[model samples]
Target: MRVLTGVMLCVLLGALDQTVVIPAVPAIAADLNGFGHLSWIVTAYLLTSVSCTPIYGKLSDIYGRRALLLPAIVLFVAASGLCGMAQDLGQLIVFRALQGMGGGGLMAMAQASIADVIAPRERGRYQAYLSGMWGIASVAGPVLGGLLVDHLSWRWIFWINLPLGIAALILSNRALRNLTVHRREVRIDYPGAVLMAGCVTASLLVMSWGGSSYPWASVQILGLSAVALGLLVALVAQERRSIEPLLPPRLFGHSVFTSAVSIAFLASAAMLGATFLLPLYFQLAHGVDAATSGTLLVPFLLASVAGAYASGQAARRFGRLKYVVLTGLAVATTGFALLTLLAASAGPVAIAALMVLMGAGLGTCMPSSLVIGQNAAERRDIGTATGALLLLRAMGGAFGSALAGAVLALSFGAALTQAGHAAGIDPGLLRTGFRAGFLACTVVSAAGLLVALLMRDLPLRSGN
Candidate 1:
């Protein structure tokens, strides 16, 4: 209980940061007079956090989880404080990047710490705890941020993390004291780490800037794409030859690890891509406000939490995960397919219900995939494996959201050109674009289902 509490606090810190800052973006821009660079406030955090995850995991495996986690918490808290005190957008963006370095460690170490104590068979239940934390963060973050911004100030969003982070640091320190540490003396692969970070940053930049900031075929985007690809090739080569790779190349040899990571990438892409679109769908198609759309998303989020809990219990009872994940991917695929055919006349309640089904299906597969990856890895490689799965998941989500956005842009561009004004744009045209996005989601989910089907079910370990 103590350990779970500690880790959940760590998870909360990371999750809340992602959601809370969104509401404060407008206030942040106005206060700093930097509307043009506002996206960087979030993008900076994302780029660093996602890029550093595997490095943190690898280090935690070499050092102790406790050793890395304490510093991560401290750094996150310190960065949060700096974020609150920033006077300009540049300062805020830099602090946010610093915060991401720690935030990534918080997430990676939390799950890796859980693996240190819990067997793969029992890990599912704990994953539910993590899922619940995320659900709470998702629901409460914007609301809390709004309240803080409206009542006090935008800076409060960052200041708010101080008390919570300190508490988490305290609890985690006490709980993790007894965690066994096996310090490895392997040479650190500095080049590989640098190469991996460069690759991820370049890739994410392409996703973030393409179509939105620049044309997909623009010189800038092409340059970024080439850099990303080149870095990736160099990274693979470095990993293959290095004495101690940042991400061990050998982990990919395990069928379970390979399959789980691939499924994670595809499933996460579909899930997060749809999540990104749904709120816009509500506002544009249903003529609802942002707050109401958030409210409407509650059922979907809650159902996801419930699905994760149910799936965890099922795994505990059945001592199996493959069929459970298969069922989930299948359900999500169906939900996305149906969404492609949905009409605006279907009403908010119907949309919410469909979201529920999709969320639940996606949530159900999440814990099982993590368990599968961990179970397939050698004991020492658990952290490495966990890191790899999460890395792919994040990358997949970026790709999926980008893909959906591209589809929407293509479909909506013609309508916008014809309408000649934002107010004159038809809801039916928006629906068409959204449907195209949903169709893309359906294809991604179906591909995930196919991967799940092809994956071999390894027996869950009864002991660590």
Candidate 2:
């Protein structure tokens, strides 16, 4: 329980960091006179965090979780302090990148640590806790961020992490001390790491820049995409021959692992896309304040938690995850389809109910996929497997957000033009634009459902 609590705190801190900084962006930009580079503040952290996650996972497998995790927590806390004290956006961006370096380890290590203590079959129960923490953090982060910025200072958002982080560090250090080490005499894959990092950075940059800052077919985007593909090929070739590969190619041979990873990717794409678009629907279509829109999302978030808890119990009882995931994806697809039909006349109750269904479906899918991936992996590769799954999910989320934003922008513009100067928030155009975005999300969710259908039922291991 102590260990679980320690890891949960770590996960919460990591999760909170993702959203809390959003509200502070404008304030930081104004204070530092860096409106031009404002986006980098968020982009820097995301790039570093995503690129570093798999490396951290592989390191924990080699060096032990305690060795890596303790330093990560310390670095994260120190970086948080640095961010709080930054006088300029440049410094804050650097500090945030450093923070992401540490934040990358928190989720991978926390999940890996759970696999260390529990059997695959029982891990679902614990995973439910982690999922719940994320759900709460998702809702609380923006609210708390806004509050801190309004009531005190934007810096308070960074400072707020210090206390909780310090306590988490202390608890985790003590609780994780006695974990068994599997130290080996193998060298770290520096070349593979570099190549992998390059691949991730280029890929993310392409996604972030494509259709927003630059045209999809522009030289800058094409060059980055080519570089990312080249780096990926090089990384794969290097990993194949390396003594201790960063990501073992053998893991992919397991159909379960591959399928689980794919499912996670598609599910995350749908989940995040919907989460991003729903607020706009509420605010623009229904005419609500940011705070009220956030509050309206409570049903979705809470339903996710409930769904995770219930799914965990069901997985334990049945000792099989195939049906749970399939059912979840199907329901989520249905939810997204329903959302696509949403009209301006739709009431709060209708929206909330659809969100609940979608959230529950996502909740059911998330933990089951993790368990399947971990269970399919060899004990030695548990961290690597978990980290890879998470990395793909993160990328999926970024892609989903980008895709949704592009769709909304194009659709809304077209709808507005068709509305022909209809005064005061054209309900017809709003509905049309939102429906287009939701339809894309529905497609993503349906793809996830197809992937879920291909997953084979593997009995959960009773021993770690």
Candidate 3:
């Protein structure tokens, strides 16, 4: 329990950081007088976090979770302090990137530590706890950010992490004292790590810049895509020959691992894509305010927690997860398909119910996928495997949001054109656009359902 509590504190810090700063963005920009580069405050963190995830995982496998986790906690705390004290947006962005470097390891280490202490058969319940933490953060973060910005200062958003982080650091130090360290003589795969980081960084930049800051076919986007592809190819080749590969090529050979990764990727894409569209649907179609829309999302967030807990119990009882995840995807796909039929006249209660279904499906599939992926991986590669899954999920979220945004933009434009107005708000036109966006979500969910069906049921390992 002590260890779990310590790790959860770390998880909370990381999860809260991702969202708790969002509401404070405008305030931060105004104070720093850097409104033009406001988005970089968030984008920098995400880019670094994604790029560093796999590197941390591989290093932890070499040095041990406790060794790496301690430094990560310290870095995160220090970065938070710097972020809180930043005199300008440039300093804040740099500090935020540093924070991401630490945040990336928090989840990977927490999950890996749980695997180290618990048998695979029993890990589901604990994984559910992590999912619940994320859900709570998702809901509480924006609220806390808003409260801090309104009642206090935007700096408090970053300052709030200090006490929690210090406590977590002390607890983790004591709790992880007995962890076995795996000392090996193999050389670190520095080349592969650098190449992999480059590949991920370039890919993320493309995703962030495409259709927003630059056209998809512009030289900037195209050049980044080409560099990303080249780096990926080089990384793969280097991994094949390296004595200590960052991400072993052998992991991909296992159908279960590959399938589980795909499920996580697709499930995240579908969930985020749907989430991106839902608020617009409420605000534009039904004329709801931002605060009320946020309030209405509570059902979706809470339902995810419920679904995660229930799925964990089910996994423990049945000693299987494939069917559980499959059932989740089925429900999610159905929920999204139903959402395509939503109209401007739909009641709040009806929308809330659909959100519940979608959230539950996502919650069920997420933890189950982690359980299955860990089960499928070799004992020595647990950290790398977990990290890779998370990295893919992060990328999937970016893709999903960008794709959904594109679809909404095009569909809204077409609908507005048909309505004979390009600038005025039209409920009917907004509804039409929302239908198209929901249909895109339905398609993404359906794709995940198909991927879930391909996952093979692997028996959970009884011992670590």
- By lDDT, who's the top model here? 1
Best prediction by TM-score: 1
For candidate 1, what is the lDDT? 0.89
lDDT of 3 by residue, 230-261 (tens): 99999999999999899998887889999888
Candidate 2 segments exceeding 4 Å error: 413-426
Cα lDDT, all candidates: 0.89, 0.88, 0.86
Between which residue pairs do clashes occur in model 2?
A: none
Q: Write the per-residue lDDT of candidate 1 for residues 26-122, one digit (tens) a residue.
A: 9999999999988899889999999989988888889988898999999999999999999999999999999999999899889888999998889
The TM-scores of all predictions, comma-separated, are 0.98, 0.96, 0.96
Ten contiguous residues with the weakest lDDT in model 1: 414-423
TM-score of 2: 0.96
Error of 2 at 73 (Å): 0.4
Q: Give the TM-score (vs. native) of candidate 3.
A: 0.96
RMSD of each: 1.2, 2.0, 2.1
Candidate 1 residue runs with Cα over 4 Å from true position: 414-422
Better of 1 and 3 by TM-score: 1
